[model samples]
Target: MKVASFLEDVKFNSNKPSVLMLMDTDFSKELRVVFKKGQIMEDHQAPFAIVVQVIKGAIDFGANEELIQLNDGDLVSLKPHIVHNLSAAEDSVVRLTLSKADSLQRVKNV
Candidate 1:
């Protein structure tokens, strides 16, 4: 068995979001992403489905043309190729899970 603390041992970046990759395997990939207030992740699309959960603080999350405010304990999911973006409303920690192994492999090769 493996164990980790999503809230511990993280280093935040002032210039951009800090990403801590927790796991990557044939079925899924998990990441702990930390964002400082005012930082943003510009619009992007993933070829695979994804799940995002807010662990701490708040964020403005945009998917396609829809925008939603996310707070700690809130979770959201997106279909493949759906454009999405996010900005920190406050310093935040988010857990992102990518669910397509093949797509992740392609991304890693790029």
Candidate 2:
């Protein structure tokens, strides 16, 4: 079995959000994203469905121009190719889980 703490051992970047790849396998890919207050992850899209969970703090999540506020313990799912963006209202940690697909696609900025 494998285990990890998303809240521990986090790495931060001054120019961009910090990303940590927690797992990457045939079945799924898991990542941890850390954003400082006011940081924004510009709109992007993925080729496979994904689940995003807020682990700490808050964020404004936008999908296809629809905005929603997410706080710790809140989760949302996005289907393939849906345009999305994230802005941290405060320093935050988010976990992203991507399901298996023919190939993992990089987040394409919109």
Candidate 3:
């Protein structure tokens, strides 16, 4: 068995969003992403489907040619290779779930 906490040791970056691996399960990798207000993760694509959950604060999620405002406790899913981006409407913490086939480096690059 394994354990992790997204709320522990939380830190935010001034220049960009911060990504930290919370845990890796048999079929997926979970990440804790912290974004400072006004920070943005430019358009990026994943090779596998992804689930994004807003754990704290708010985010302006850009996808499907529109911007969706997501607040605390909100969750979203996107299909593989879909262009998406995120902007922090406030200091926020997001939970990102990636398929086991995905690469952590790709997320860190964004």
Q: Best candidate per lDDT, number?
A: 3
| Least well predicted 10-residue stretch by lDDT in candidate 2 | 101-110
TM-score for each candidate, following the candidate numbering: 0.88, 0.89, 0.97
Stretch of 10 with least lDDT, candidate 3: 5-14
Candidate 1 residues lying further than 4 Å off, grouped into runs, are 100-110
TM-score: the better of candidates 1 and 2: 2
Error of 2 at 63 (Å): 0.6
Cα lDDT of model 1 overall? 0.83
Model 2, 1-110: lDDT tens digits are 66778899877667777777777777887888888989898988788889999999898999987999999999999989898999999999999888766233353122
Per-residue CA lDDT of candidate 1, range 35-110, in tens?
Answer: 9999898888787788999999899999969999999999999888888898999999999887745344443322
Q: TM-score of the candidate numbered 3?
A: 0.97
Q: Which structure among the candidates has the greatest TM-score?
A: 3
Q: How far is candidate 2 from the true structure (C-alpha RMSD, Å)?
A: 2.3
Q: Which portions of model 2 miss their true places by more than 4 Å?
A: 102-110
On TM-score, the stronger of 2 and 3 is 3
